[model samples]
Target chain A: MIKPTLHSGEFTYPEGTYFQAGYLTQKNAGWRTARPVLDTNACVGCLQCYLHCPDGTILETDDKKVTFDLDFCKGCGICAKVCPKNAIAMTPERGLSQ
Target chain B: MNTRELSKNEYFFGHKACAGCGGSLAVRIALKVLGDRAVAVLPAGCMSAVGFNFPQLAFANNAIISTFAGTASMMTGILAGLNARGEKDFTVVSFAGDGGTADIGIQALSGAIDRNDDILYICYDNEAYMNTGIQKSSLTPYGARTTTTPPGTVSRGNEFRKKDMLEIVRAQGIPYAATASIGYLQDYMNKVEKASKIHGTKYIHVLAPCPTGWGYATDDTVDIAKAAVDCGVWPLREFENGVYSETPARGGDKAEYLRRQTRFSHLTDEEVGAITGGSL
Candidate 1:
């Protein structure tokens, strides 16, 4: 019901430009961001994910297990953001998810 | 558990910036990164008059509006004055427009950089003398429109390429040097933070857009800015000592980037290609 508010730390932006306060958006837990999602049946082994995933999220696998690390995903949504097939949508997580 | 999107009035809303003023955005972001411990060394430009024109100074922190050619000189003095009183916690930021930095202020800028002054000199470059109704300046790009470089049947715009200011300063061998854009707010802010931590001269050239000067609709301010970086004409990079670390060479094609502005509208495909190709 209550969305968490970000604490605008001690430092402020004095200059008129974009700047990161040397901090990432999500850093409360040791876990990294969970970024990508996949649709197994629709994949069709086309190597699109292998070719397009900017961070090498999908590797070539003969068995089609197609392992993905949620933490490694920048959630740039490259897979789903550019998915030619209507597959790979990202959803909010609730578990002790990576 | 918390996400209070930064103070509602970081630039202290209602200071009188034009609808699509990139120079105003430059002032906003610079002040935001420096926070309360910041002292702005402003000069005679649109920014000076933007502050409600009277007592309502837009800058919430300690700020000084000085002469046009004295931004760097005064900033050096201000920093020395502050350091003399043992107030080393605050930052002295020298904010000037391209006309100030690339022309009138060049002498003082050289003096300060020569002395290795402890101040951050940010040149919010809008390409020409925008505040003075868009006259030509040394930083104005080739074949771009300005009052002095108006397009005629024979000419597209200014004949000379923009003077290489970053390279000029790099020759001074200061502690830091960088080029940034308001379009890439995060990248600009990160450099401000880095410059804030350093002890000597830091030259940061921010590509501030001027819809009025560039002859564009007020709404295209941010869009134009992003196109600048995405297009390689303004190579984002930094220098410290002899080391050169380019700000990621993110490439954006020329046409989509330069077409909206009236200044570049007259530029032929070949002209745009020549300027944007390796102008960096």
Candidate 2:
């Protein structure tokens, strides 16, 4: 399990130290009803989609090809828009089961 | 051009903003135009929440956190310190939300502009206090229903129109002031590029849409922002050297724009007619 970076306890940092407030875990963005599907056959391993994934959903395989965890992908279409080989396609969640 | 043609290096991304957040996209675009030599001063706003994720900062450039109403003065101090050190190769930008800019930070903003500080102040107007729940703000539109301006039996929504921030910027006799939208990417980017070259207090008010606060689907953020400008609700204009030049109006369907967001859902037919038939 990922340890929480912040807690409800006393302030730990020293004075004059700056800090930001936000959830430590990756937010559940699965409400996006759509996700990106990558065609590995046409994938050029350019890593453009990996660099542009805002939610950090895109992961790299051992073969240097890119894949992403759909659970966190918000389907912003940034990966699709940035794909050089046009290998990534955003498909609706319900339609994927069909 | 899309993100591919803009630039390869990304300065800001992989943060905690909601999906299809126009403010996040605006930060990306602003950083794209400002380039690597820019140091961003973010106030207590959405950008602060998203950009600085604590121990894992998303912004690649040098960024500092400022108090809610202290961004303008902080930027001015940074500029002055850099000038004193003979470091004239960097740019300073203050990115704040509507609440931080139009409401809390306006005093410091006026003072900075009055001093003619060489900095860029970018107000990403999502219309309400979105970070701390949707609350009515001075920049919120007249007919919008924020948490503080909920429609009731005797009341509709906010009865006051948006504060004219561009006019306020112009009143300072600044060198450049403009309004932008993410829908008009090329135009917005062009304006940022131009502002970076100028040497005075430049302000660009971008119409950023909040999906959760505005009660719209995450996917419709860009479309709603575009509709807002095309429907005459938010006119895209630019002021250079005390001259105002409005962009050619693109008459989009106003009814469709209002029907998409729940904040403006309480608007009556007569009120809609009034908005459509009025100067807009």
Candidate 3:
């Protein structure tokens, strides 16, 4: 997980604002009530979900199957809804063991 | 640009936007088109509030928060300052919400356009002010219930029509202007790309839905956005070179579109007909 360096009282900070791109120090998986489960066999690499994802958690794998970075996936179910082949399902997060 | 051809890099991500935020999607996609060279200016709206958290900024590209009403003015300043430093191949863009665009920031927006500043100002219209607990703004459509515009025994929600922002900007003779919806991603992407290439001031009013504000299922954000366009509540059109062109609506059922959103659930059939100009 990418984390931000916290400045202590003893250390002097930089004069100017400086940070990395896409700077997220925490996981947002707690926000999900339902998690998207991908069915690799049924996937056709359409990438509609990837395009529509607000969180940018959907990832295209080397073999053309799509996976997700659940650490930041808020599980908005957009991937499931936009899936043309019904390969993605939004399973309730309560019962599932990650 | 199609889905496959879009930039693999995620410029806007890892923020605290809601599960299915249409505004975030608009920002993410627009930034994707604009790329790293784009210097984004967001006002005190959803995108800014959720994006620029103190230590964890969501935008990969250079971005900053402007005053609530100073979005366009800040963009003008950025353009001027960058030009002074001899900067090139960079787009100065602002992502402001409906309240910021139509209500508080209209004057500055008008001023920027009047001066014909080189910038792209995209207003992600989510109907109401969603960041401050769903208050009604000028862009809120008729018959939609908000915290400020509640429907009661005698009063219907948001009695006024949505402000025609596209026409308003076009009236100022902006070089390019268009209306886009997240449901139609390709069209919106094309509009963003086209606007980025234009020399003078360009404006794109995108109809972004808010699941929390609109009282709909979170997953239905894109679906509802598309339905608004198809039902004629939000028309997809473009204004360029003093001419107006609109994509014909698919003529989707307006009543069904309203029925899906709880904000409009209180409306009677007669009231729904009234909202749709008696076409229903």
Candidate 4:
């Protein structure tokens, strides 16, 4: 997560634009109508979902499995659609028990 | 390069782009291929609007927003400035939309290519001016409904055919030019990788579907893009060193591709036939 430094009126503004690498400080999980639920046992790690995700929210696990960074995922469900093994399902966001 | 060998580091992430935004996907994948040393120039389109939000810049690389008609001009300036400073191993690229490319920024793009500038210009053609609401761009296909070209009594969406951008750039005698779709990931990736290694001006026009503008379910973005290519509505081709070659279309059902989108829901059989050159 990126922490933005707020600019107050006291300090002089720098001439050059200086910023840390781009990152979102806010979570877009609210945009999801349905969230993807992964079936790890049925998964063959082809990384199709990882390659096709529009938001770059899917991450490859160390053990060759895949996981979602729900904090950044807008729940587009491209992962579920591209999954060859049908290892992913789009469950309604409201149905998920927190 | 294969998917397994692609860079693990994400250069573009955490933006306000809509869920299943195809333009974002194109930018993300291209940036991944270009790596961190890429200097991205964006015009006043969806990308700059979504990515450069004051204190919340979404690009992980060095990115700046240029004027709407100045993406290529700005890229040339950046390349010149970098060259003056003895900079090496940096790729200067631009991500412009359909409106920015075929209409507003064509002159700048032509000038850059005429000069044989070392830059890469990528037009993520979503087929319309989607950022300011769906308006008809020069690249918007015939019979596709947009805000400015709504279908009505005696008027059927945009009447003009899409401007052939690949051919236009090819006519300019560019060193490299290619048309790609997000559906074919490996092909698009290879084109981007190949474009980066070339020394002169490169233009890649990628068919990036807009789910919001096209009135399709968000999950169907890639499927719709693939269908366009499969049905021969969008052709995948490349122009290099004065030669042109195209991937053969799979000859899929054009009606299936059209009926899925609300924009073409009102297209008559005759109109569809006309758009497909009686191929149906």
Q: Predictions ranked by DockQ, top down?
A: 3, 4, 2, 1
Least accurate 10 contiguous residues by lDDT in model 3 chain B: B271-280
Runs with alpha carbons beyond 4 Å of true place in candidate 1: A1-98, B1-12, B277-280
Query: Candidate 1 lDDT, tens digit per residue, A1-98?
Result: 11112233465544753232222223222222334456777766554343333223344457653545443333334445444674676554545355
Alpha-carbon deviation at B232 in model 2, angstroms:
1.6
- Model 4 residue B153 CA deviation (Å) reads 0.8
Candidate 2 docking quality: incorrect, acceptable, medium or high: incorrect
- Scoring each candidate complex against the real one, what DockQ results? 0.02, 0.15, 0.48, 0.47
What does candidate 4's lDDT look like per residue over A1-98, in tens digits?
Answer: 22222232343334677555474455677888888888999888899999999988888888888999887789888889989999999999896864
Clash-forming residue pairs, model 4: none
Worst 10 residues of 4 chain B by lDDT: B271-280
For residues B1-280, write the lDDT of model 4, one tens digit per residue. Answer: 9899888877777788999999999999998888888999999999989887655668888888899989999999999999999999999999999999999999999999999999999999999999999999999988899999999988899888899999899998999999999998899999999999999999999999999999999999999999999998888999988888999999898877888989998898887776667542
Q: TM-score for chain A of every candidate model?
A: 0.51, 0.68, 0.79, 0.76
> Each candidate: fraction of true contacts kept?
0.00, 0.08, 0.53, 0.49
Better of 1 and 3 by DockQ: 3
Separately for all candidates shown, the number of backbone clashes (residues 3 or more apart, or on different chains) is 32, 0, 0, 0
lDDT of 2 by residue, B1-280 (tens): 3434555445665566887778877887787667778889999988889777665456767788899999999999999899999996788997899999999999999999999999999999999999889998899987889999999877788888899999998987989999999777678888888898899999999999888899987756766777889988788999998788998779987777877899989988888777667643
lDDT of each: 0.69, 0.79, 0.89, 0.89
* B117: Cα error in model 1, Å: 1.0
TM-scores vs. true structure, each candidate: 0.70, 0.82, 0.95, 0.95
Query: For model 1, how does the per-residue alpha-carbon lDDT over B150-201 read when each residue is reduced to its tens digit?
Result: 8889878898888989999999888999999877666787888889899889
